[model samples]
Every structure is written in C-alpha cells, then in structure tokens.
Target: MVEPLRPPPRSARDDVLTYIKTLHGHQHHDQLVAVRSLFTWAKQNGLIFRNPAGRIKVGQYEYAMLQPLVPVQVDRSVAVATTPATRLILTLVAVHAARVAQIVTFMLNDTDLGNRRRTIAGRVRPPDDLTTQRLLDWLEHRHRRWPNTANLHPLINNQTANTSSRAGSHWISAAMRGQDATLERLRVDRQLEEARVKGPDPLHLAEDFGLDEKTAMRYADSARAQLPQAAEQPSQ
Candidate 1:
C-alpha cells in the first residue's frame, strides 16, 4: 500500500529561532529545563543519538529595579512642570505617594479640603502642606479653565472636560513627558523616603498607601538595604 506523503522535519535553525522567542529572563530558564527533559528522555529511549541542547549555555538575568532620581533630577522635573495639572500630579506622586491609578480615579468629592484629607482608592490619607497646597492650586486652575466641565474626576483635560470620563494614563504620562523623573519614579522615591524615615515595615506601607503585599514587600526590601543603621533606632 502507498504511504501518505510527509512534510520535511524542522531544522536546527527552526529550533534555535523558537528558543530566541522566549523572554530573556526567568522564562529562559524554564524553557531550557523543559527542553533538557525532552532531549534526555529521547536519548534514553534511543530515539536520538544525543541531547543537542545540553551544550547551550544561558546566563542568569537578574532583574534590577530602576533607581530613584537624585535631588538635581527631582528639581529639574519640578522645574519643567509647566501646568497646574502637571504640578499637582508630580506633587501627588512625590509627596503624597499617590499611584497613577488612584490619581486618575480620584473625584472632587474624594477630598475633604477643610480636613486636609483625601481618599485614594478608598484609603484615606492626610495630605501634607505641600500636597494640599498643590491640590488647591490645581483645583482652582481646573475650575477656571473648565468651569462648564461635567467630569466628576478631579483631573480633566480638553478631551474629557465636556464628558463624564476621567483622564487616561496616557494623558497623565504625556503631561510629564519631558520631566527628568516619571510619575512612577517619583512615587517609588516617596515610598522609599517614608521607609527610610519610618523604618522598613511592609505593613505600614500597605496601610498607608493601600499597596498590595507584593508591592509593599518590594519597597520594604529596597529600603532595608539602603537605610542607615541609625534609621532603625527608635527616635527619642
């Protein structure tokens, strides 16, 4: 009987190309381990002569977090902030430790200006003098520019002022495009600052900032390494 026609087998080049598609960090290790197992089984079963992938070497890719900006960078970033909106966002990130998500989702009613308190994603935090001052400036500017705006969100731009929708992350990012430090970097620095002054307690971070366990731990870990020995001592 005639047998069915078969396509050609994939070449070593094809295998190598597939390997290249893997992400260059933890994923590479996982992919190599699976490949090694498959090749070892084939060799033991006499399906192939040897394991071809065994000789390939993969270096470990340890992840490194981006360092916070120095004082000069921070000053440069603040200096370049040309608008009230940008200034408020920067202050929120740098001083209030507000996350991008919380900032975008905040509404006018979320703040108790008289009490110097604000709600971010359901967590109540008392704003410092700087943060409160910036908030007042931005709110006044927002009112002057978009008085007829129906958008309930505290943040509004030309695109969303006429609508009820809140400003997007892209808009927020664009507002700080030329700054030396991004909102995220500033946020991290704020957390790091708190950790430095208050000690590396993940629970405190979680409570204060409404951060998840993982994120709180990451900040705490970074702070633990950088904090001076005197920082851990209780203040008199």
Candidate 2:
C-alpha cells in the first residue's frame, strides 16, 4: 500500500492558531482571544517570522464567534428555564452581554446591587454592558431564596482546594443540565400562556412587565417562533 501523505509544515502562528482552536468553548475562547491580541502585538513589534494569520480575515475564525442573544429571546429563555440558578445565569448573560462564565460566577457584595456591576475574573474583565442592570434586577427578584448574606460561590469548582470526585462532577453536570432544561421549558410555557391570556405581540407584555423594549420584542418574537406551526400558520 502507498504510504499516507504527511501534512504540510505549519508556521509558528499556524501552530498557535491550531492550539487555540482546540479550546472550543468556555474560558478557552477568552484565552484564544488573548493569544490573538498577542499575535497582533508580535506583528507590531516585528517579531513574526511568518504572518500566515494575517491572511485570515477578522471575524472569519471559529475562535472569533460571539453572538449576542436578542433581548426578547433572552427574557423568554430565562423565564422558561426551570432552575432558579439557570434563570439567573441566562438572564445575566443575555441582559448584560456577559459571558456564561461571568454570569455563573458573579460575586455579590451588598455594594454590587447598588453599583449594578461585578468584575469578571480570569480573562475579559470588561464591566457588564447596558444589559447587566437588567440581569441584576431579575436575579435579585428571582433568586430571593438565595441567602441574603453577601457571599457567592464560583460557578466552576474544578480549581477549588476541595477537588470534586468523578461522581460529583457527573452529579453537578446532571443538576446543571436539568436546571437549564427546566428554565428553557418554563420560558416556552410562559410564552404560550401569554399568547393565550394576552396576544402574540410581546411589546405589550414586556411594557406591562417593565422590561426593556428591545428585550421584550425579542422575547415576543422567540415565543411566537416557538409556537406550533399550525398556530403560526396564517388564516386560510
């Protein structure tokens, strides 16, 4: 049999990109972002032996993918999800344009509520954008069962001093997934209820609920889209 073809030799920058792309989700994306910035800095400093990455267009890389959820969809999904924690997390991500990591691990000092912002750790420490306040408000309201004490736990515990067992990891994953699924289902159910009690226009519902117009609109649109095809079909 003919020998298999060896892959083409990759430049240092190509190697770096390959390494970063391996980190598909979570904090790895943030790390890759830093790597991209470093590559830029290297180019500026004339340190690049080969600039293969230069040929790559900005926004073209899978590493650069970041899509903000529409406000209405954010609201609906948070509302629909079953777990209070999941709802709060999704709300934080959608409203504040925060990463899922930041939302999950947000610290709450008594002072945080007044200021309406929290510092995201590790990478990408930018303060929450326009939507953060909305998330904070909803989180405060929804997770009232959460202790009034000004303590918060990190969302991911792999790095903690008390390491989790395999069983614990599995349990945590199941619990989190179950909660998230519940929240999504709840949002769908709420949307259906709204349609029955009110009408299809989410603008009115959002206005009544004191949500941002854009977010409300997004929720209404998502809710409408999720409805049964028969219900969505136009009158014959």
Q: List the residue pairs that clash in candidate 1.
A: none
What range of 10 consecutive residues in model 1 has the weakest lDDT sum?
59-68
- The global C-alpha lDDT for each of the candidates, from Candidate 1 onward, is 0.80, 0.47
- Report backbone clashes per prediction: 0, 17
Across 123-216, the per-residue lDDT of candidate 2 in tens digits comes to: 2223454345554555555345432423344232323313321112332234335343333343334444454446657666554444466556
Local error of candidate 1 at residue 170 (angstroms): 1.1
Flag regions of model 2 displaced more than 4 Å.
Answer: 1-76, 122-151, 154-236
Worst 10 residues of 2 by lDDT: 160-169
TM-score of each: 0.70, 0.29
Report the Cα lDDT for candidate 1. 0.80
| Candidate 2, lDDT over the whole model | 0.47
Q: Quote the positional error of residue 15 for candidate 1 in Å.
A: 8.6
Q: Which residue ranges in model 1 land beyond 4 Å of their true spot?
A: 1-66, 229-236
